[model samples]
Target chain A: MILNIPFSDIVFYFVAVFMVLLSIAAVSSKNVLRSAIFLIASFLGTAILYLLLKAEFMAMAQIMLYVGGVVVFIIFAILLTSHLGENKLSTPISQKFLAVFLALTLLGVMAKFLFNTKELSESITQKSPEASSLIAYGERLLSYAPNGFVLPFEIISILLFMTLVVAITIAKKDNKEEK
Target chain B: MLPSVTHPIGDFVRENVPNVLGYLPDFIQPYIPSAEIATLINIIICMVAIAVVGIAPVPVLIYMERKVCAHIQCRLGPMRLGPHGVLQLVADIAKLLFKEVYAPKGADKFLFYLAPIFVLTAPFLNLCVIPFDKNLQVADLSVAIPFILAMNGFGILSTLLGGWASNNKYSLISSLRSGAQIISYEISFAMILLLVVMLAGSASLGEITASQSGHFWDWWIFKAPVLGLLAFIMFLVSSTAELNRAPFDIAEAEQELTGGFHTEYNGMAFAMFYLAEYINLFTTSCIATVCFLGGYHAPTIGILAIDNILNFVPGIVWFLGKTFFVVWIYMMFRWTFVRPRVDQLMALEWKFLLPVNLLLLIFGVVFLAFGWILP
Candidate 1:
């Protein structure tokens, strides 16, 4: 759809700026809460870009699942150390060497793959069709035939199942606590 | 339907903007609402809006609570602060703001501060998808209820974490009880939700409200009476527990737990959590209106097709009115109601509410199969 609005471009630039600011905050905040909040800002900024591109469902899903579910879960986990973790406290375990080294190596390898991929053909960009996220998602979700949801749908479900099991096991009642 | 022009900005520069100066602005328009980007911007707007809306109710509702509580108790209550003690809430907030925010000695400091912000930002973010007035929503998505419910569930994280992070035994104790109550109640609440979704035959909030229009008795609550009544009752119980309001306010049983989970918090951080608790008050009300009360649907009339004509009044007002009513009802329970023990709260969720929600879900599926709603 042609959005003839004169200032949509201005907002897009703001979104980009917001993303960078959030990334910086996420990386640099010594306070974990602040970092998580910045992370949420990053996700929300990304979701807006998604909406601007007419991908409303993906935007909402990013907010709902990632920000709402995943981030909240992580924040709560941080709280697990709440009683004992009140200050700008540092962890005793110093794995900085392995962590920083592996991170740079991974980034380099990913960049290499992006340049060397064999399907280095022309980029494909399609304008989004107009449909509400819920409706479109349900339709795509149910379509498992010729043009199907066979792979991705199953993968999503499998991921959800694994997350469920992992969460329950980790959070399950500890036998030692019972004693 | 509108035609889309995917032409590069430089190509359209001559047609739209007469100057090269407007180049960058023209370049950025087309890629706006694609996916993550639009949602991100919309979420930020919603978060900011919530800060204003969320805080407003903190003072207003606190004063209102005092007045209401006084009436119930046959006393005039505070008449000194502002008009009829209207400024009482303002005074209270002032005191909380100036109060020394101390991380008690030996307290794990980071989680102590982190807890309040976690509890607070949630309500702001959740408010994004709600349509208060038709054009006023920051983001209108089809999966609004699920989105709302999911947020409602996630907000509990802040509550539990806030409570546990304090390291005080009282706070830890409150977190345990509150966490279990929330998780258990949510199961029943979710079941009730599936039932309503089935009955509506649509997942989008806008479509669900649209599907319920007709005469005075045409609301979905009136359409599927049993399921509606059951869902409404269960939703009420769960929301009471979810919001940690009276009868279910295990998080702050001062007599026993010394302000429950918030024992270690003070100052502005504490105030944020306090304000957020009220935002949840309004958020849950909005969710209930969207799901069971036919949202912003106007009642049908005898002579005029009132529902049809009233659709012009913007879907937001009816939504607000319905939501306010729910909020008021919940508020009455909060201020004027008697408290329930922790065990009773647990039993209510596990025994009474869960079975009702299960039954409602089953009926909803059957209703869908019978084609009671439009495909």
Candidate 2:
């Protein structure tokens, strides 16, 4: 029997495999800065997966916020704090062993849950609607309906504004104190 | 199913490639699947086209920069290489490519090598979404505007990584400055882009251009009168700062940072950074043209006769003409203005541009909602 595979399936598997591998590398890398850079690679892999899933808006947002904003911020912090040539950044072997064990156990549990869910949902999967457009996502986000995200969106915005305000106030106070 | 070739240039090339391939032996031809061959050829052609658009103009732009600067300073520039020293850039490129690729002992070898690749890729990827002419775009993703923003945003990583990997004080400081400056200006830049998207009621670059089609007056810069004009100016200013072009180029202030984030880079790696910068400048200018200048559209003042005459000219020519005009304006700014100090650059973004941009965005939203924009 011949196996006929679609192009998208190939891309999906490629991205998925890379995403998992990069995520592990991101967590396991010795150098903190290198780890941060690896995290960006992981983020990019995830973005590609999003693209393969045909969620272009989410893919771009993933790159913009995760790779562009968060990862850069992480790199900045790493650069400002770490000594580049020093070998002091690596974790102890015992801690590394613990991390690997915990990761494997979590993966096992997730795999079990995923299989069970897949078995349960296989019958109903075809009834699921297609992914909504970005416009629909926006409308849903701003909607005040029963399942709307308006409150969460507003709360998040307010929280962000407060963080900005507090950050500026603290920075200004530091400047004044220095003066 | 065969993909319909919509672009004139693409169609011309597509029609010719199979004929060229047909001349090869039957054994060689049968070895390659027809579908795969076509797809491969198309991909190659696309990459070449994009590279030509992104990289081919760098030499000319560099020449223009030197000439413009020299003329401004009342000195003749590059009169030796070719006519008016046009080949000067060619010589410089050749020299740079052959020059030794160097890394300081303290540099992070991996990042030091990877930084230039990232820097070069960012601008080239960003070029994919630009509607060069109607149907000439490589991809017209529905989220093209955000995609462009995201790709351009990733450019900061190159500078940051390059500086960090160099292990030089000057490079580190400049990279930090670049990171901060780019992030700060991106807010205002995004605001301006959002204003444009709202006006057009679409985030797709092609759709945005389509909405603005018709007379010169229909261009977004003039479509909403005061608000559109302000948004254009805001976009121009913010984008200039975003690109780290002077007078906002504190990141690469020669006296302060030596060669800036790329201080340790030499030879082809340095050339990559230079090429990326020029390509980015070109992309920004192209985006500005597309967003505000009605893209490749000819100015039609509703006069049918003149409009007909104007339409005789193909769109790609108009696109290039308008884009170069914007590029010239940017070149003028580089030579004409003094570089701003870092503090002043921050203040300009935070104290002035941000507030003004936010206000302009509100105005734009209201106007758009009220259907007050020009037809």
Per-prediction DockQ: 0.16, 0.41
True contacts kept of each: 0.19, 0.47
Label model 1 with its docking quality class: incorrect
Ten contiguous residues with the weakest lDDT in model 1 chain A = A120-129
Q: What does chain B score (TM) in every candidate? A: 0.83, 0.91
Clashing residue pairs in candidate 2 are B215-B300
User: Could you give the CAPRI-style class of model 2?
Assistant: acceptable
Candidate 2 on B202-257: residue-level lDDT in tens?
Answer: 88888899998988999999999888888888888899998889888889989898
Clashes of each: 44, 1
Q: In model 2 chain A, where is the ten-residue run with the lowest total lDDT? A: A121-130
Instruction: Residues B192-277, candidate 1: write the lDDT tens digits.
Output: 66677777776666666666766546666667756576678778878888888887887789888999788778888778777888
